[model samples]
Target chain A: MEADELLVLVAAGDQKAFEDLYGLVSGPVFGLVRRVVRDPAQSEEVAQEVLLELWRSAARYDPGRGTALAWVLTLAHRRAVDRVRSARAAGERELRMARRANGPAFDQVAEEVEAGLEREWVRRCLDRLTALQRQSVTLAYYDGYTYREVAERLSLPLGTVKTRMRDGLTRLRDCLGGVA
Target chain B: MTGFFRRGDLHSLAAPYALDALEPPEHKRFEKHLKRCDSCPAEVRALREDAVRLAWSTAAPAPAALRDRVLTAVRTTPQEPAPVRPEPLPRARPERSPSRGRRSPFAPFLIPLASTTAAAALVVAALFGVQASRAQDELAQERAQAREIAHVLAAPDARSTAGRDAEGQGIAVVASASRRAAVVTGSGLGTPAGERVHQLWLMRPEGKPRSLGLLAGDTPLVATGLGTNAISLAVTIEPAGGSPQPTTAPVVQLALKSVGFGE
Candidate 1:
């Protein structure tokens, strides 16, 4: 069954279906959380929380609303962003940024290898966006920066950044038509 | 669709909002705007589809042990109860029989009301109780109103559209044609200037606009009979008691789309 059907069963408190859902979604959930949170242990904790939340709020999932994968990823992304926005991560963010600036070869190698074919598709779509649009989209989604923070980072007007984010996503939506 | 106010300004935030890039205040503000935006939900849904692909692109295998921990937690966690979709309301005339089966969610606070007069009486009592500072009864009325709002929101066919005044104050209507009702909520309307009040009007395909009610601060107004040919919803400033007709031009006017009722 598709993820949508699995989610419906999960909503009915089907444990076996949930196990299947975990198999389908855990990698993307953990990977997205890890990208934003960056700490291995913390990412694990957040990912666990997200997975638990899916089981807890499964019934609220409306099949008419959108695809189940989209729903699950939204929950994962929001939770990851919430973690980075919290007070504890305020200090860790600078450290993560410093680490990112140094661009450790090991992390880069691991990321490139693990990213797989999905990353190739996203990278191609992303390349179609203007340089500023790509930067705005990435800094916010991957870095968990607020739009204002993105504007400051990019040295662009807040309005300009907001438009770019909207335009960029619209372009991506068109380019990746029907993929989700 | 007005030009200078940049009315679409807040609507443009749907992308950032979908990406989870908005900070708390902007996040809250945009969320309020989103509920009433007709095009926004679909737009946000599409963008989210793309956003998830971004999440998928970075997919890394989770630790094998983490699965055991999550499954263990799931075994003990109770799932939220799914929303109860109320039985189809007994069909009543769209305009005259406003309150018949509509209070299904509030049946505990109120008996299943049938007569329009009795429901009207409860509304009057609910209003007078508020004025008389009767706490317990007022509480019940508030709960009923809240549930009524929730009922419309939870309706499977609920559709939202939003409009803003020239000064940027916004109003959004979430209407469910099947329920023949709509909930109107606004942000930044601010308090009407001394003794004046904000009034709601539902314009039909023909005839003068009908007064829905007076806006009570931030409280959402639940108006029924959306199945009627109500073409647009307008808000205008009026005298404290409200006008028989709009005394002033509408500050916010959202054109209503035909929400098809499922027979």
Candidate 2:
């Protein structure tokens, strides 16, 4: 069933539909969360929270806003980023640990050559972006860094990071239009 | 369009907002703009669909156990009611004044209007007074709970340890040796089934475990009256109000000493 239809059932408190939706979206949600939170244990915790939230707030899902997958993944990403940001704010020790244990930085060429055909296509589309554009997009989206943090990391002006992200995502949208 | 957002600036935020890249304040402002703007919502929807492709690129199989956990949670957790669209408040019609251009024939009857108005005002005031007192009581209870957690966390002899369940769910215990009080904070444990709850137990070096308390919701379970001789902490699903002895296998367990308290 399409996610929208399943979500409609989910909104009506349909357990079967919710299970189907969970099966459909849990992998991407977990994977996206794992990329940001990094810790296996913490990632799972955050993923569970995100899914439970999806269940509780199913009625709040507006089909007109976006696709169910996009909605769920977006919620997952936000929660993961919130976890990382809160951990960083907890102490310098946490920030230092997170930095030391940080996942691989976004590397377009390396990623392209390493993945299967599907991911390879994504990587190639990402490669179409300029170095700065890709960096800005990757740091903010995948790394879960805010625009201010992205600016600081890349040593670019805040306005520049914002523009790069906007332009870069637009370019990516057009390039991945066929795939999406 | 105002100082909050320059002309066309909301358009640029569509991508970042879609990707969850904007900070909270900017995100809120852009969302408010989204409600009114003609073109930005479509732009955001398109951007989100594209962003989903990026998310899919990173898809790795979720842990095997997550499926059961999620399914169980869906089955057990109560679904929230669909939000009722609030009806806009009725605008007040202009009130006819007794001293207006044309006084109604009943004007004399409203001569005691001052007294009647005073009585209605007293009733409204009394209702508000009761509501305020009730709110204050709830606030006091919350404050007391916060103070208790703070006292436990701030104790000089406080020690803490954290570990994960088999499914990589986090559980942490913080206890003060002198006070014999502890708090168990767990993440990723679903709400227990009907008439059942996650129960915290303090296991002695030998013999059966003793119940600390039945955990409620996701809040940290603050348990007191602990014996210093208890060697470890464990959690299990048990009948509501708890059991003298655990009826089910422990979902997670951790040694108290591992949290760094010296004997």
Give lDDT per model, in order: 0.66, 0.62
Model 1: residues with Cα > 4 Å off, grouped in runs: A87-93, A98-115, A177-180, B1-6, B83-263
Task: Write out the backbone clash pairs for model 1.
Answer: none
Candidate 1, residues B145-208: lDDT per residue as tens digits? 7688768766765555555544767666667766889877655678788899999887542235
Can you give the lDDT of residue B109 in candidate 2?
22
On TM-score, the candidate that comes out on top is 1
Q: Estimate each model's TM-score.
A: 0.56, 0.54
Minimal lDDT window, size 10, model 1 chain B: B86-95
**Model 2, position B39: C-alpha lDDT score:** 60
